[model samples]
Target: MESLSTKSQLDMARNVHDMGSINKMREAIASGDETVLQEAAQQFEAIFVQMMLKSMRKAQDALADENSPFNSQQVKFYRDMHDQQLATDLTSGGGLGLADVIVKQLGQTEDSYTPASVIRSDGDLSSLNRNRVYNVAEAQDIALSSQSIRSPSAQKD
Candidate 1:
């Protein structure tokens, strides 16, 4: 039973690690926050493009000799960095337009919204309820009082 539980826990951990970014993107899209959703979509597109680049590199024949001075671990690391930067630049500069399509399909266009700065003034808690705002001291006092009320020792005293 213990071994089964441990195996299940390991599987859960691996699934969480693999789906972390995807979960974040889903959350952003579901949050109704246009800016965050758009940014997440763009980043996802960038990652997709980077994966494509890596695959393409793997498919290509190595033109450089193994004994060449330019062929080293550092060179490979720098090449990966270059590929990452290229992916970022391509996405930012409207590379494949995948992000744009995603944003459009999600119906989060810039035309349908106003900036928050223009809508709300400073010190605006009008939308928030009273229960949402409380001091830490007040919370601690409430907790202490609740514990005292619930304790059998307090009742006996």
Candidate 2:
């Protein structure tokens, strides 16, 4: 079973999707303060976008460096995923553009990209709670194995 820490991180990442809705939910559950909810929502959205951009940049840099062992094939996967992530960001209430750098580095065109399938396909939050956001921290064989890109490259961080 995945640990609670991992689950919590995944929840945070998934929650990054609907900042407004999340704030409303939090406010409704707390005391129905729309202003507090709005502020909280903005904060969450900002933090989420910041984190995503940072992660995307780091991943793109790591992948692009030939010595990093990310390799061309792995870079391709990460690139595609990053592109999808960028598309999703366009629909997000908070506008961020970190994915643009990653997409450019990957040599992807705007037309070739697609939006986030997970968010688009999934329904409401309570009904659509996702599994853990997979990360290298949880991988047991990263150092033990030869694969440099051990986890799914499609993942942001």
Candidate 3:
């Protein structure tokens, strides 16, 4: 289990928000009038595809952020694993397949989420709940601990 750093947690927060929005957009298309649905279907798929691509970029951003302790090599490894999983899923006719890949890699699926980022009744991005994502005692507390082990000067100020 890999503990999420602040940045990684934030990324998860954003990912959840984005995914919720995407799903809502999808649902709206489904519930809308026939002409609206038809028009939205094409635009929605394009936007969803872009959302998937953006998520990949955001994942890398989280791993590379200054607050993260993970090096490029480590991030690359995780990213590659996710990419491969996504590719396999896509090849199997799965759409986007990001949520599954994230779930498989992180063991935290987006749907029915309680911990991490919060969402609205319609599943839109709501205020983030801090307690849900990171805690010192969690098995996956990869984030650098608040307790310092090195000299004060040696740590980042």
Candidate 4:
């Protein structure tokens, strides 16, 4: 029974067609694999697209006539399959760039990355003073003092 559940979880994570499943993220992270991470991110993006399409279909169905042939169960099943494939194709073709963003955020090395729970659990939060900024003026002054500058890189001509 336990093995069956575990196998299902693995299948959910590995199957690109199962856009709604995201149960194996912990496994992917534990494996410490970039390709796995990339695949997971892509799958996440595909899931997002699928959800959007599902919602759009629901909205479209709201005004749909029940007596219409287009509203048949077989038609809906085929339509859903089409949407799933469309989502997968869109993700593979660079998608909405959500996968790239996910990869960028989570692909950091252990040394450079610290989980939020660890920081709070350590109880070394003397740095986060409550009265650090009492007023808007003080906050503005502090923000101005340590303003971060960003340099935009122009593409090569």
Candidate 5:
């Protein structure tokens, strides 16, 4: 494997989204190519970490200043680049251990393994907890009830 620059590595990581690139990664793992397997696993892990970071950022949108000059497209681009680099660095530093798990599982099998059955659960909300499924009214009621339960002395402060 030739040494690739950060940009090249990022490009390769982006290519992992393509079916052909995924198939090639599977083939490399099946062949027990340690270098390729490690690279692919790390890239996959970085993607996962990046997704997590994106989700966290999205969740923080409510707290963001809407009128800030730093909220422009250029800032967003830089933030995304920062996130990508952070994901890569985290994965290289033994991240959430996803890469290790992926490498271990792939290394254990001589051939690529496929599930015998596929179960689809699209649009299913039955698994959600009551709190997660609560309507706005119900949530407000809960908040009010909780506030009512607070001690008068504590509330005064």
Candidate 6:
């Protein structure tokens, strides 16, 4: 029953003019289901993709020949419909990875976020050298030397 609502919401989500999707989004939030939250993120990403397509179309139209039949308003309407469907299809197929990022960010509790720059993609942690032991004596000698340098009275000629 909830899955049907999610599927319908995903469908309606493709059309920006559909107000029911907003209510559906509220329901998803109220339900607090992980699956519904994921769907909501995808739905949002699909809408974002549709808007990007619309912006690209607008940019293309700026250089278009107004006198040509191809640039007609009717053509634009159908093109927008096509773009909406395309956005939906693209989102269903893992999207631009924006939906995944969205879910990952929102799913984290508070202390679990590893900053983007700190996340290594190479699958190598050798650079961190977590197993290396510190030489406490060497560290103490260095710290004392620095302290003596700062307080010249402690430095012997």
Error of 3 at 44 (Å): 20
Which 10 consecutive positions of candidate 5 have the poorest summed lDDT?
1-10
- Greater TM-score among 1 and 3 belongs to 1
Global lDDT of each model? 0.64, 0.50, 0.46, 0.74, 0.71, 0.78
Off by over 4 Å in 5: 1-32, 110-157
lDDT of 3 by residue, 63-109 (tens): 67676666566875676556544443343333555444543444434
Judging by TM-score against the true structure, name the best candidate.
6
Residue 37 error for model 2, in Å? 1.0
TM-score of each: 0.45, 0.23, 0.21, 0.56, 0.51, 0.57
Q: List the residue pairs that clash in candidate 6.
A: none
RMSD of 2: 24.1
Full-model lDDT, candidate 2: 0.50
Superposed by TM-score, candidate 4 places the C-alpha of residue 92 at a distance from the truth, in angstroms, of: 0.9
Residue by residue across 1-157, what tens digits does model 4's lDDT show?
Answer: 6445644565455545654455365654465534666777787898899999999999999999999999999999999989987887788768999999999898887888988986675654354453553565687877766636223342232
Superior candidate under lDDT, 1 versus 3: 1
- Poorly placed runs, candidate 3 (over 4 Å): 1-55, 58-64, 94-157
Using lDDT, give the best candidate's number.
6
State, as a TM-score between 0 and 1, how close model 4 is to the true structure: 0.56
Per residue, candidate 2 scores C-alpha lDDT tens digits across 44-70 of 455566566667766767757676655
> Candidate 1, residues 62-130: lDDT per residue as tens digits?
766778766777887887778876776677657698988887777655787678888877765654534
**How high is the lDDT of residue 130 in model 3?**
39
